[model samples]
Target chain A: MEKEERKKKVKEEAKEKEGRLTGPRVIGRRDVLKGFATVPFLGAFAGAWARKRHIERELKNNLLEVVHLTAEPADIVPVAINSKPLRLGIIGFGLRGRHLLRATGHAEPQWIDDAKASAASNRLDTSYEDFMNQEDLNVVINGVCDVFNIHAEEAVEAGANIFRQGKGGKMGTVPKRYRTYKELIASPEIDAVIIATPDHWHAPMAIEAARAGKHVYLEKPMTWNVPETYELVKAVKENNIIFQLGHQGRQTESYIKAKEAIQKNILGKITLVEVCTNRNDPNGAWVYPIHPKAGPDNIDWAQFLGQAPFHEFSLERFFRWRCWWDYSTGLNGDLLTHEYDSINQIMSIGIPDSVVASGGIYFFKDGRTVPDVQQVVMEFTKHDLTLLYSASLASDRQRGKVIMGHDAHMEISDRLVINADPQSTAYSEKIKQGVIDPVVPIYSFTPGKKGIDGVASATEQYFASRGLLYTYRKGRRVDTTYLHMREWIHCIRAHIQPSCNIDQGFEEAISAHMATIALREGRRVYWDREKEIII
Target chain B: MTKNHHLREYSTFQALMLVLLRVSIGWHFLYEGLVKVFNPDWSSFGYLMDSKGIFADVFKYMATHKDILQAVDLLNIWGLVLIGAGMILGLFTRLSVSCGILLLSLYYLSHPPLAGLQYIFPQEGSYLIVNKTLIEIIALCLLLAFPNSHIAGIDRFFQKKNK
Candidate 1:
């Protein structure tokens, strides 16, 4: 073995010496700079190239607007429950919290038959007035909490069905209000808690709720920053409690089908996935109007500041908290998390190896800190996959989410469509047999319709429908948030893991923070697996 | 003209000519890429918007979709730099030239020289379905085809050493 190795080395050295003599021995460095001289040469001539084509600025603009190719909500697994009703305490009865409450049980009194009648009446609806009755869900909104007395009052009032005032069923009673989340979570009457506080308060409140032996149904983003992400997940696990992250899009039907396609390897070595958000409306962009009743009196200014920095009572900051970095996680946590978590749910991608994000506060210059436009690229090196997320607040162009694989690509927007790649090796056999045609898609699924079932603007509802935020059953519509809340309630009683459970929530928190850190610091951020943190 | 004869030796003028072509193309890529890198406002947005000829929708799509548009912007900028640097330095000739071919081809296809499409801007020269992008692609093709051309490059020094 040694003799053979010695012989190989001698032959290699001889080849190297021969190689040196044969090639140019002294190539001038100046000769290389001659290459750079072509810049102006190409640049000058490329003009003719640019000018040769007629400009269609508007056509280009029309093409570039955002798309809404999101999937519809999944049907709740129909199962009989023997356990008694679970008491659900809700903290942060802000806009999203109120909606969650309505979806969970508030719309039980209403039905899909009403939405059809409303749609027939030509009313633009975006309310949770039509979801199927989750009568089997063991949940009662017993405790309501918010720093703002008005929000708390509205949350409690939201439970009032005085129309059925004399009836002795679920609609008869209303939840008691609390000023602080601590007071609400500590209550012995509450069996589980739904937290929809500001981004900063999520982890602190979730950790406290877990310690108090309450199951958690936290809203999107899951946590504010990196340490909070770890601590919250730890608390949930250590307490052995069921924790559901509010990426209600997990119930999206196209997402479920897409996940099935991925598990089947129908796309074959999936590589790149792109998800986007585009909204032209003011409310959609996070400049939510400051309420007329908002003030330091009705709102507890100090307590609302919870884990965030203290600021003098500013209604704009309180109502439009999503516009600031101190109280929010910007686009990554606010909007991109939806796409990220949805894609994560389908692909089962835990954490990306690295995240590189870029954006600016383009268009909406309304004293807001978070960028109205943002883009994030996440690389899962182990899976050889890349997740791309782009959000634009100024534009209404709907660039839907698309996942590209070697054999095919799955697009989740108006429908779930899978197209065979013409050059795919995996599909070559089927292609040769004329079984797989590139001209036609291999699979297509349209789960829900573009419905204005609830009392939101057509634009806002378009952005919110399970199809984008509102979901549909047989000829009737349901809310994705309701379906999500239903699954959590069922899982809580059955002692089974919910769809967007604690571990998935942890991965999502880490992923969103990775994007946040990357965008904020203007650098490439990597997940240190051993250390369980982004660096 | 025999393949075996050029393997041992080549004329000095021939080596200079080969190096010249390599350096010029390298410079073109590097300079174009670097200019865009330094200039934040620089984008292919105009080019994509004004795209005509075959694959007009492809060009328009690239211009319209933010994700693809952003990617095209970054890839076009960085890809030019890396491939141009490789060509000039005579490192990874095959890999660099291959990438250059693909990039130039995309550019060529984006707006072909097909007749009947006219615009208001000043055009340098007129040719039927052929232009500078195509010419550069041919130049890159020549660089890739010739193994001995790399003798004028640093790749010669580390040619056998690189794994």
Candidate 2:
């Protein structure tokens, strides 16, 4: 019996050991401690992350207090589209004309089809989507005018595409095609005229439209020469018509912010401003491909010459009129005016006190009179600064617009970036205190980018520095041209002067003319502020 | 129960090293996820748009499609966060490591360090066929192969209860 009891006890002990090894065991302090060992690391991470964020927030707040600019883009007031549709007449239905028409909610069937195909093939190409989503401005093309027969017919078809559809889609009423701009401007059915003609014809078409009591949307440089500049301005003012010069840069969000920054004196004492244009393509150089069917038979060569010097009915002169001084205002009117107007919009630095310009057609030797490259320097003695305008059609090295000040320099494009100067008296104390870094932007404003990124990445900075043809308003990408046209239409209905009014156009025209004179004379030209003349 | 034999074979130093590696990776993922989650404007647009390699078109499509992009952004942010929490807490460690490997693999494929490829976002260090992302992925694989979470994690308690 004793032997049997010992064996049973041994077996029971063995069963207990097996139960300890395979079955659930009671929780011990050591087991609990080991299981929760890594929990402290998570607590440490949270603590460290919070502390780091606090320091960054403090620094960002300090920097923002010093800057005193809003992180969000300026608010855009939505225009009401309740009024009756304005009857429109478009002259010079060429490249720029087609673009302007599309901005005003009219695109040809071919363009619509092509844009759709492109979007389908490449998802990144949002052109078709953006165009289709564009708000429909209440306007109808009542009249169309172009020197070329094909362009006029195309404009008619595009005007009839009210549904914004592709080929074989629904169509609307076709606009009446006028053989001449004067005829289109005189039509009683048209309430407004959009002149997208070559340089020589801008003033004449605008003058006729203004006298006919029709609102005018004229493309830059405003006029081809000095005398016509005065004539166009006087006609528009005398007629009391809404005149909007096509400086779509006026609608850029960065320009608006830049204007505010200047008003706030964020850039201390202004010293110099530099703006540039760089293009490296045949089309950009005015070597536009000649239409095969374009010739004396289809084109109205006589009317096309309008105010331009008489030239043979050559397709080159007719198509690429910007290449010659006879029909074009050279680089000054064609390109420099864009740069000049953008500066004027930002600084309100009207006609410069004096100007000196020089350049030659160094790149393209395609029998063109206008220089393919040019540089113009305008002295703004009143503002205590010098405005430098440079152009290069041979190399597309982007040198963006910059406004320099004693304390800080601002680079403005679709975005604005302000960097404090190292030697700046205003920021030296902050720099020494390590509150500000000269290499980093003190104030960076990217239109669509939310909030302030005090230290934006290099890629962000690069993109911000690059020029964008489109601008953002309220975090939405909008065609600046569309905004400019909408502003003009709004002004016409409201009976108010548009953003780029006759006064602003006068400044733009006189400035461009002074540069052109300086280039042609190979001497410095002075602007007589009192006489309002370039001498 | 037999799996416990290999789990017990790891020396204290070896288990500590494995736990440290897992936590460090978790920290990286957690921080990355939190930063993006806090920033309202953050989007995978730039990264996907800059994608190179054979699957570039597919990634680019995801970036351009608004609904798909939103979904992708949510998935990426939450995936990193949950996977990171799982790794650090040693809860479902195997699953976390597997998910991390998959995420890193996608990143590696999108921006492979091939000889002729260049990226807009400047890289900190020069790389050839191998990069930091690839290294991290390999490390996650190592963790997958030798999981010691039950030894020094919340998994230890659950493991004991199950036994």
Candidate 3:
């Protein structure tokens, strides 16, 4: 009887312990004290450590996948290895060019090791010191000549074997480096030339580079018009020099991963994509800071005015080049191209069938010839999707990209946030009943047909549940300049075409340029894919 | 609430003026706050002086020393949002007006672009500071002079609810 009583007591105690373990336990003061008795700061420490580990794991996974994709060849089945660094030669020593050079891996050699030592010593000064010492590039040569519009003798004097056109080349003064581009291209040591010149000069310089047999890495909004882009594309194809257009975000790891996730249907069938860039500050809207030294004497006045309407050389146009229409494609070509390139890559969108736009020079009453705010809607046939792209020079909210699809919508910025909306009856039913039989396909209700905008509701719920509107920073968000330069180097070594090649660059430029035309003309422009023209 | 048996001459005129006043100021605050919220690179706390220059130093300091700055940034963002919401809704008008003035004042003081004591015409920096803060302060004064919230707002509804 006593033994039976003891066994009953033991079983009752076990039940109590299980309840405390599995169920939400209302701990008394004594129990709380007892919990913390063993390790005073254990809970706090563990929580922090767990969070760090989670973030680190995400970053590591991102790096691993990106490294794999970059190393592997699409043409071949699968060979995964990170790409080797390629050699790069920068021509200009100006601020913009210098920034690009600094970004292209020319910082400190032993910065990483120094960082560890600093961490051990708990010295922030050492950390700063390391950063200063560390270079971001393997090799960077200073003061290369702007071969564009200069005499061939001067180009040779500047030791520029790989000739590049600065803003001066926009006026059509072929640098005297060689009488024709043929001599420049035939140079043995010159492998590639990066044309970081104005819009009008882009096609001329790129064509020259292509003709020379030297690979070309040209800046954004590749050409002036659709016909120009087509011509440039032809030249690139004919020459087959490794051409990389300067939409550097395509080379970024975040963008590559985002693209992969979308291709893998991580966010389901994408239907709507929205991109916005708002700049409250003057500088953000491409109001270039006027250098005190800026004048006709300091700047190549006539050269800067090339192809532009017969406006005299002024400090304003020379310094604030982006604000002028003749010099640039305005905000659409300058800022919107980056957003568009990333959007197309992420959602696998080719050229859009039609583009509708609305814009005007509404703000910055400063003497500028381009619209400060613009919105464009491009409808793509393949995905049956429409992309909404908007930019405001007056406002500051810079929302990156939001892609909406059937199953889930993703708001992509520094990270890819896949949100599962509850209103998605398909998703909800799948969750509740679990995966249905392979033979039984689930039918989804469209927003209009359903009582509620099901997808919208699901998106709202998804955001609410997560206590966040979007997931941020899945991996380290890179400075795109470095990524672009790295790709250039990588292509140089591997003999592979960079992701944002001539064709992609030209297409991106045409897309934006057409939109600008549409907005300016106040008419819907139909892109004739057959003729490769914007009507 | 007492019903107005004696219809006064100034009441209608006063109502029109109050509505107009509230809306204009409310819009100004709303737009200002919204613009800052939208700008991606518009950081609340980043720059601190270094060899690079004032702007670079401020940004570098904020980026490098984020621990304290992050907390401050969160408050600033939410504070602006709340101010915007309050001003636009005309709910707690006086409180919103005072808060707006205080915010502008604090910002002005933090980076005072003031001249020496021979205060003649205010410089551009001073002019900018004074322009925003003065408007916010006037809005506060107006709210105080005539409790606009009580006239036609959530405050009136709340007053009734409490009663």
TM-score of chain A, every prediction, order shown? 0.77, 0.94, 0.66
For all candidates in order, the CA lDDT equals 0.73, 0.86, 0.57
What tier of docking accuracy does candidate 2 attain?
medium
lDDT of 1 by residue, A4-78 (tens): 999999999878866755655454565455324333444654464355322323322321221123333444566
Q: Which ten residues in a row have the lowest lDDT in candidate 2 chain A?
A: A467-476
TM-score of chain B of each: 0.87, 0.95, 0.63
Candidate 1 residue runs with Cα over 4 Å from true position: A1-82, A107-120, A123-129, A132-136, A162-171, A432-434, A448-473, B1-163
The lDDT leader among the candidates is: 2
lDDT of 1 at A437: 61
- For DockQ, the strongest prediction is 2
Task: For residues A177-212, write the lDDT of model 3, one tens digit per residue.
Answer: 333333544555456665666676677767877876
* Residue lDDT tens for model 2, A201-269: 998889989999999999888998889888888899899999999999888877887888888887899
Q: Which sections of candidate 2 miss by over 4 Å?
A: A1-18, A71-80, A457-476, B160-163
Pick out the ten consecutive residues of candidate 3 chain A with the lowest summed lDDT. Answer: A444-453
Ranking by lDDT, best first?
Answer: 2, 1, 3
